[model samples]
Target chain A: MHPIAEPSLLLNTSICKANITKMAARIRGWQGDFRPHFKTHQSAKIGQWFRDAGVERITVSSFKMAHYFAQHGWKDITVALTCTPIHTAAINQLAATINLNILIEDVASIQALEDHLENPVGVFIKADTGYNRTGIDAEDFITLKKILAHLKDTKKLIFIGFLTHAGNTYHARNMAQIKKVVDPALEKMLALKTFLRKEFPLMELSWGDTPSCSIYNDFYGINEYRPGNFVFYDYTQVQIGSCSMNDVAVCMAAPVLATHPQRNEIVVHAGAIHLSKEYIQLPNGNISYGKVVKINHALEWDTHDIIGEVKSLSQEHGVISANKKIFAHIQPGDILGIIPVHSCLTAHLMKHFLTTEGNFIEMMK
Target chain B: MHPIAEPSLLLNTSICKANITKMAARIRGWQGDFRPHFKTHQSAKIGQWFRDAGVERITVSSFKMAHYFAQHGWKDITVALTCTPIHTAAINQLAATINLNILIEDVASIQALEDHLENPVGVFIKADTGYNRTGIDAEDFITLKKILAHLKDTKKLIFIGFLTHAGNTYHARNMAQIKKVVDPALEKMLALKTFLRKEFPLMELSWGDTPSCSIYNDFYGINEYRPGNFVFYDYTQVQIGSCSMNDVAVCMAAPVLATHPQRNEIVVHAGAIHLSKEYIQLPNGNISYGKVVKINHALEWDTHDIIGEVKSLSQEHGVISANKKIFAHIQPGDILGIIPVHSCLTAHLMKHFLTTEGNFIEMMK
Candidate 1:
């Protein structure tokens, strides 16, 4: 049965495949490992596409997600979120079956793992480098040394390397700005590695973010890259030049359900439930949370311009004010394509996706 | 297995139960039937609570959801979204087993549904009130009458009555504004019913929306009231006065992972993944997308007054600016409770809820 309207979620297979190729080439060029984050495109179908394009290792935000991808036969995995004491058993259980890498920042977390973990675990010491969310401060060498000293003899813990998210790329205004934030951070990590060589000569500097990963001409000290959103860049990435407008792999196809003459707006089937509320700061400082793209034949969308600004959103309806020129042509029953402000959140909200041909593609399943 | 941190979800069981009681009381006092919309608190546990509180019917946003609730023993269900051709089989399957109600705004949809349906399906005409979304225009009585006239002899189609979703309440500034928009719309529906009753004697008027359903004192012509968010009011509802701050039943319980003085902020585990991007416009027109609330032992949160505005959020972390006087008291590792700006999308993103006591309260399963 044909739906009265098109599904709000849409994923272009051709564009997705092209994105995978581009990300794989970038990783290969840098001589870095490609462990794409599963959180961006939680679909196993998308994961399979990644695997088919030669991606063997993967990263996920949660242990449950690791298990989700693992069930689909993914062998190597990294749970990127900090391991909580509550999830120790689940992690151990997962490790007993696959090569699982987990991240930790504090000694207390390590102690917690030591007390309860039953399986040997690959541990990555998370380093703080300006993102400042969940990592040990790089300048705090004493703290790092203390953690290394304690883990040296622990049979259950295998120190893998050091990991940094380099999330400041998200706030960067341009390529120069991204290099300004990431280059010094990479230098600091390399310096720390040199100073600690006598104690741990095998530490790897793992760093990744789509903005930095996509633009960097050099990976001087990085051993691994984890650019998840590169597979499906959104409005924010477009503004930062991380991905060209044509490179965005996913477009939410929403039906224009209502047009408000007074507001010069059209209501769409897509809302917060479909496209997440992540916003990009407009030049005027007001936010353009998302942009209306033009969905093409292959389900690929032309996202060169912002057709509509998501002025307000409810659960099931996104209130879009069509740009002056576009408003004149739009009406109820037409479809509008949207590129989310943040691809990660938008992908997470859509538990599954629909291909151009209308097949129900389950990404997580 | 224990997670390194608590999951970023919280369902206030006590507050949820209280919300149920209050909605039930209001419906009873207003002499209207309570058919709570399941889209907000999608949990079967919460739905069962409503059933136990004497609600015999409920509303869902999609057919997939209607089936989910039906499997949980909800016999009478309404799929409030516009009917489409693709969902006809599912709707027919559901109608065969339960008292299923569907909505349509145009003649083509009704014709498509009639062509594909095998069982008698209950249908309602979705009317376009002041909100101006999917519903057909009120002046199009000839079109509606033509639709009703066409369906008269179709054995598979059962014309029930007229249904209207006063979605304009989302734009209202407060309770006064919501009442101002909803009262007249309700009157319009009543007037339409009176006109239609002369030709079709068994017409019923069904109304949905938390703001319209909760604040209004009277429902003179409405037969059934369907309010979803009142089960778990969020920051938007608190501002609308449909429910008080203490009445909010669910929130995102994020861990304060790091404090960055350099950035003048603290990061939490919750982000757009947990809290959908629904926002509340402040009196000054600045937007507060989501608010940080207080999570107490009984799983009930304090009123919206305890709110600390979350200025900005990312995919994995939300940066709450400590620039405010109140945020200065917060420290790293404390849990920051967040009341989502829109509860509907946030509730839907969470596959299930976790109680304060750490039980997996599956919303679907």
Candidate 2:
């Protein structure tokens, strides 16, 4: 019943609910609007858990996801990733029904929305505070002004505020390094918010990134919070000092296929197709695809006792370097719990989750 | 219609058919049973294309895949990965209907199959000739004898021959390096076959690995050939000299989201969830997630003109470092074709394929 004879993504509901409640209260304490991102756990049932925790608005990364949550009755939905012209049809459809928001960085995107959108929709100028992944640079006021001017002429598009996902915090090694990324990002975002406030007084400041939201308490100038990964934190967050290992709510229960005790290795059925190829480089210079822990009698992983690390992965096989104690005690049929390096990718690959209570939660397949 | 307003896995059916024909003819020339592994494409329609090329039997990586191909009229099927007890239910079900073969390396796995299998199934001893990923070592005769003895006592398991996957050939840089890995693997496999043939005459020799099968011509003693990646040769295959870039049959049609001319980068809507996180290291010490090529008027990629490389990927965004010419020509709504690093992982992540002729090909979900 636990491992289910195949690779299963196990979700601890108690831990997940606690995570949602804590983050909701923290954002409330900062006096900011809590619009938690739903990209991590794309499930309607999990969304209800957030609803129970007083979260009304949520963020997603794609138009498909926006349409999914919209169908499931999420009213205030933001497609957090930048908008392209190709998704205009979806944008128009979602905007027709829900309180939809989309991100825009340039005049081209705004022009696309104006050209095709039939219903009014909220727009957030995606600003690159520091992470150079996407979004317009916060200091690039020329482009920002041009986008804003174009949005001003549009009848169907409403400019909301500046939104930035400081994803650079993911690369931070510790709390101090996370602060190093967050402090400048906050400054740039705050500066942009101040500049835009003269014209749009109600323009909100949206900050998202799990590390900054989980580690730093001071959300001084931010009006909205949108951290996604805090719901089911993983080994990467623990490495970044965003959360402890105990806070991770998901684990991959994989069946042991074969063991090479001479090589101190055990092969599991779960591989890149199950847990994803995301890995973490340890301080000792070893790469860990995932951390292995034991499943207790209650079907929960013993986070206090990490038994091994997944060393390598092929398409459908994971090679784990087990400790002497576990390797000696393990057999080919035993199920071992593997805490994935990145929970979002793992959850996406898995497509659904199995709660510890033996209930299946469906995602947006 | 080309990009379809979202990331689509574009399969060039002509190139794919040509790859199948060429590989089928080469294996015929070597007088080996061509049971091409269907794990790469996983599509039933693509399996029909193999039937068109005169391939009767097939190889898969899992029990689920075996069930899928068996449903589509494949009679002789082999699940090439090591068998575990947890999958005995699927094994028994498949074996009861089709001529199913399962891989076994240890006595424990054999015992599991022996205890639960209701119908007689063919069993192949997976030998670790050189790749230490899984399977029994070729030199471990004592353990092999024990496993054979356990199988001898079983009523429902028929002993097939030895099989090995020389996956080490994937790490080879050139033909010479590939030969270096293949020669030792074949020698050890032949040695094991020779030693076992004294007791079990007419035992077949099965060998599978895309790199060795694509590069080396000589399959002297191998009775079966199982190469999966040749169906959709990827960037990693090109780097490993398994196939040229022109032979690659699939490309990800990703919609361009934004262009950062200041940074010489263009971000596309496809990311790890669409294209997978597998990467290749260039000779210059830079990492390449995928190679970028322009989509031509025929809805196929211009493989000759390598335009850029996907420098990095996040959850739903791939940042491509494009050349000046392509960058200038590219816009926010344009579609760029990306040849993935590993086609199997990419295909798995994509879930289905859209043929160049505007046809949707379904895979096993």
Candidate 3:
């Protein structure tokens, strides 16, 4: 197929294997357990890559996703989101077979899990060190103490450790800024562990976020790692200095629908529906949806190769402001590769993927 | 079976039927052809409703969508996007069977169509009245003359009329701004039509944009009207004064996973991936992704009745900022209805829909 007049998400497995290998080597040097979050890819075939890279455990966002991957031979998993009462049955069903871990924030969630669970599952108290989206405030040890006391009575719950995600690191501008978020969060995790060690003696700390996990080499206070986006680091991570340009494994290949030589722009078929609406604010203050790249006949891209920037996007149209030289080569029936701003959302919107070797990879919806 | 942890796109048929009836009645009195855009709903079952309401024609955004509706008994359709060289085989395949109309913007597109088209397909020259997204500049009669000269030599093309969409009406703040965009576009359209009609005496004009078609009652110079988002107008249309709150037919029913009563916020499972990440700024300067409405036991929402606003969103989490009174009642296992900021993109993001009557409607992918 031409892949023009439509958008196709192209995956380079060779680059993806390199990314996986790089992350696996980093975790091995850190001497910590590698449990990459499966929410980023949500594909059984990609999960197999991690398994082959010696990643024994995994993390997912939903119990339904946990079920989907468990069916594909993932024996250990963590439903990373807050376990709610609505997911009681699905959680209990998965807990019966796998070494499932669930995040518990409030005592009510603990009570619901205690009343409904069929088998014992490891429970981690979600602590909010900084990015206060959700979770128990790390400063409020009283709430954690109460939840821990309540967990003592539950037969089906094993109070294991604390979990936190430095999602604020996504907004960091550089290396100094990323460590400003990672250092404090690690300090808070160790502080929380120190207080709990007096009572329980053995408590693990699990920190998961791509920026911190990719930049920081030392995980001295952390026990387990669960960074998802490193498998296909996007332009966001690249801008924040979390990963270099070579780490990005996925890019959108959209067909050129029209070329405006006077405007020096190329109109591509990929829009917000194909590439997600999330954008990266360049240092020059220009908002870019994605970075345009030239693809060879084999659909391989050199990320450092400068082409153009996707300037604006609407529902089904992406306007690329390229130079006259770049615009001269493109016509109505050409496909231009775009390194997406955020790979996770783009991959999710594109439910199916085509590998460079001409294979279709289907993700769990 | 329980849609508590995943986002569910909920459709209220009564409200949708009312919207369909209102548009159909308005178009009947206009004395022009009513070709409703099927890109909003994308469901064969919803197309049946338009068929039942006496809509003899339709407009779709892509050739694949046209093929879907053509299979479902849509005989008259306009593929309203720019027809590129890559879509020749599919367009010819479609033109062979139905009264297909495709948009042509440049002379290059015309020559390509002239070469590859197997059967005659009606062609509309896309004219830029106001929105300069795609189309020939309406004032550039030189390009139109060249295209017409080229079309005269073609064998398998029918030069029908000028087509346009006043897409800038979406960014209007009020009715006055909408009219500011609508009136001039109509003036230029008439000017273009008058210039073209001197040679082609039976020339027509086609205009389609939800705001323009909904607010303006006069279609004196237009022979065809094609509006899509009026089928399920969202908060953006409501903000622009094209439709009231009562006119919106579709709202997303998302699950409440957690609540922060102290902060007066609720964490929802619906996020940018589910709701398409489109936002509408409130009068108070707060950004809202969607309007929250109370859901009854049957998951139906009264469009006028709103409880709170979805304040912010990440990839998998939407934070709803509500009052203490609203937060006091919600728990971890509740479903809330959200009237999306943009219905067209939201509907396209959700692959399927569930009506209030518990019927599942599958859209064309």
Q: Judged by DockQ, which candidate is best?
A: 2
A1-365: candidate 1 lDDT, tens digit per residue: 22425445676677878988988998898888888887888888888889888889998887778999888899999888766455677888899899999887656667778888888888888888877777778878898888887788677778988888888888887889988998888987888789887778788888878898888887786788888888888778988878777777677877776565555677777776777766677777666657886565455556665576776666677778676677667655567788788877877777777776767677663
Worst lDDT window (10 residues) for model 2 chain B?
B324-333
Candidate 2: lDDT over CA atoms?
A: 0.90
Top-lDDT candidate index: 2
* TM-scores of the candidates in the order shown: 0.85, 0.98, 0.96
How many steric overlaps does candidate 2 have? 0
Ranking by lDDT: 2, 3, 1
DockQ each candidate and list the results: 0.35, 0.80, 0.64
The DockQ value obtained for model 2 is: 0.80
Can you tell me the CAPRI class of model 3? medium
Candidate 2: residue B261 lDDT (0-100): 88
Higher-scoring candidate on lDDT, 1 or 3: 3
Give per-residue CA lDDT, model 3, range B173-206, as digits (tens).
7778888898889888899878877788888899
Model 2 per-residue lDDT tens digits across residues A274-309: 999999999889999999999875678998787799
Pairs with backbone N, CA or C atoms under 3 Å apart (clashes), candidate 3: none
Two-way TM-score contest, 2 vs 3, winner: 2
What are the runs in model 2 whose C-alpha is more than 4 Å off? Answer: A1-3, B1-3
